[model samples]
Target chain A: MGCVRRSERIVRLTRHLVDHPGTALSLTEMAEHYGVAKSSLSEDLAIIRSVFEQDGNGFLRTQLGANGGILFEVDVSTTREQEIMAEILAQLSDPQRILTGGYMFITDVLSQPQILRNVGKMFAKLFAKEEPDVILTVETKGIPLAVITSEYLNIPYVVARRDHNWSEGPSVSTNYVSSFDRRIQSMSLSRRSIVQGARVLILDDFMKAGGTIKGMIALMEEFSATVVGTGVFMATAEPSEKFISSYRSLVTLAHMDEMSGSVVVEPGNYFTERM
Target chain B: MGCVRRSERIVRLTRHLVDHPGTALSLTEMAEHYGVAKSSLSEDLAIIRSVFEQDGNGFLRTQLGANGGILFEVDVSTTREQEIMAEILAQLSDPQRILTGGYMFITDVLSQPQILRNVGKMFAKLFAKEEPDVILTVETKGIPLAVITSEYLNIPYVVARRDHNWSEGPSVSTNYVSSFDRRIQSMSLSRRSIVQGARVLILDDFMKAGGTIKGMIALMEEFSATVVGTGVFMATAEPSEKFISSYRSLVTLAHMDEMSGSVVVEPGNYFTERM
Candidate 1:
């Protein structure tokens, strides 16, 4: 404990903060682990915090006192957010990504670990102030985004399935009109997935007519849960009349030409107009 | 570039290495970023590497040369693996988790970022040497596991859907026998999901008769891809005759009592036998 190298303590501190996001750790525990006094540990955390905040990666909040510790909050700087959105827009602009319908193939982008982590950080930051008890999204495309966001938020995520499997036990199902085809479709959530009266945040990969989001909100109501906020990676500019009154999107598909196979995307409300 | 503190360089090095895993960065670049000479940067990396390796969280591999620098490789130590498996086993042992079909409720655990990250690192390490170009899994349960594994391996993941959506554009579908119900089920993958002759690593949350994994392998064949390795979080001890013989699991359900609603699980091959 007496001879711990300065570099060694810094690496351990950074790794600990990275691994356990949103958790407040007491200086006493950290000091003991690093084999340093509380005063020296505070200095090390100060340097790490300054570097993290200056770089726009995240911030370390320290609460002074015997019980007060530190918490790591991940945030995306305006510049980083723009860079990420631009990269996503560029990726989604490929003509080959266009499918039979107006849908673009975003599975590749969603599947990339680095891209998913970055986007997740962006969304987590946007909703950082919200005390969401649980993250909710309907299967299956939104699963990754929701899971990653839940990770950063230090919360559990519940996925509503398009079809109910008996293995999920008793579940509550709700029918909502599919905005895409104006057809009625139902989504179900396991009864145990969420507790009643819990605050829920809805996360999805895309928002077309917002039908799925609406259905999810309804499903949440079945659990008597509160719908705190909703977020989507992309939303079609058309059908501006969304099912939900309010939500957030990272990018808006301003235009899509199936005949010519072209896509025009712009940053969503998260960037274009911040709250 | 000068006057960089040891703690400062260590923190940056850890953050950068964590962000970009499985990629080699040049020592020159690292030296420049840390504002220190190559020798000092090397010393910092050595300290970071030792702490990481000793802790069994992950390791940093250094390669000499202009092109080669350091690569972050994540691996769970034997003791850590046992602790994690034990914890999961306890959670899975919940009586209420027993589903109508002998399946245990694992959605909550899989969606938890901490649990998924740990399990993912284990799977990633088991297949670390495989050189997989992509990770594959069928929706919707396996999406989180696949995504996390892809994150650790630093590769893209492609999810095969139970039904083909026109929005996916051109896709290849195949019929495979479901081992559970002995029913024929069809799964499809977007043509763009994987490139021909690409090496693929399959990941799943649970393995029964291995029908889903087998179906994924067939789907890969349709795309002219190679199945390098397959990993699952849990597998049934019974059904000795699997669709595929070679695979790895983190835990195995040695026994389950549907009547009594009890389950017994043991650590998977990942811990029982050395590779």
Candidate 2:
């Protein structure tokens, strides 16, 4: 390779740090890799560190000592994560996204990583005391957060499908009232999926009537599993007659009036009250 | 408050660090809060730093300058994040969780904080070059990831609902094949929701045939939105016919044989090849 300039060296070094995890590289090592002088490499690393910190991804880390080098840290904060989630929830709360079927468009919100991280952190912290053996949620909207939370807790998650498959030997079915559609729908889970007596943390994206959560709680009981705790991304505080009780919400939909262009949302009480 | 012990003081100090992001506290101040000596506090901080680093959450940063104190750097690596994601995929790939509907119980996997953090970083890195204006995905499974990615990119995400609501004016509808169900399903998006000519990134949880992806792409085109890139959490490499031509996958499902109790998955080529 031909000679690389100082700026190019900085970008390459930053990208390398991003690609590698935990391992730190010394100034001399980086200098040799880029065919640059140690002094020049030091300057380049300074610029790279500033840029990585500016990006909020936490990619470049510096250590001081004889064996010290540059390490990449991938951690992001709970609040920063929460800000992203609040934005998505804000979008989802838009009345325009609500369909006649009473379902809100959730794909955009669920697919994003920052929001998920914050939401997952919230779940992990809430359940930290419970120390559930597994996380549980009903398909398909609940799957994203449940999966992320399980990973954080270092536990497995099991999904309760809306319907049974031919491949599943046998399944237990239950009735759930749809909060959005306001209709009774059937939910099912394979008999062999969840381990009996496992402490399960139930999660969902949105809960209005709490029907699905109730159904899952019932199913867990049927499987001899304990419902340790319940969590939801968004919950409507209006509906008083919920199927499941004692659940935590990240954000609550306080009010929405499309005709008046009025919508109100606030961080749920869980943040302050939980700890 | 009564005098707190050294260990209690350390836990309280760490909690404070976790709560106050971007703010550093001096060792003297921390020691004063707990009524402990500066040297005792130093030892306590050392233990706190070790615990934080061991968790892979971040680091307890110390500075010796006049204005410097101790700060926590919540940094994680892309590789470590990816490793967590691979672990989640492995859990999701459990054959016992796959129901007859050809769906895996993945709700728990999506609800994790660390996984979401990694996912957000992945999208930020992927879209750093293009810097798309908005993220788009169809309802339900895709919402969590889309929300997380949008948060990292600091962009808004738009969800195309599967059906139209009365609040939304007129919606454009399209027919798409469901890869899991292997059936034709109708997908719809409100015309007023998306901005025309804006660059959009489409995201989803699983892609077998890419039919829904095509529908979203079409919906984007209808609004004159540009499809900058597409992404999915899991994609089946087989079934060559797909709705979208180019996309990135976090994990690839190579094969599934129920009778033989064989299911194989590996990290997607996207990680190894991309920056």
Query: Whole-model Cα lDDT per candidate?
Result: 0.84, 0.67
DockQ of each: 0.69, 0.10
Q: Residue A44 in candidate 1 has what lDDT? A: 78
lDDT of 1 by residue, B1-275 (tens): 12236667778789878766787878887778656699988877888899899888788987666668798998788888888888888888777777877777777878777788788888888888889999999888888888878877889998888888776778899988876688899999888888989999998888988988888888888999999998899888888778898888888988888898778887887777665
Model 2 misses residue A10 by how many Å?
22
lDDT of 1 by residue, A1-275 (tens): 32346667777789888776887888888788767788988777898998898888888986576667898888788898778877888898888877766678777888888899898899899887878989999888899999889878888898898887776888999999876688888899889889989999999998988998999998988999999899999999989898999999988989888899778888888876556
Compute the DockQ of candidate 2: 0.10
- Largest lDDT belongs to which candidate? 1
Error of 1 at B109 (Å): 1.8
Residue-level lDDT tens digits of model 2 in A1-275: 12224323443454345434344688777778767788877665565555445434454557688878987555445556567656866676666655444444454555555466556756775685686887878866676678667655656676776766454457788887776667778877767667778898899888887877888887887889888899988887778667775888877777766555555666765665654
Error of 2 at B101 (Å): 9.0
Q: Candidate 2 chain A, which ten residues in sequence have the lowest lDDT sum?
A: A1-10
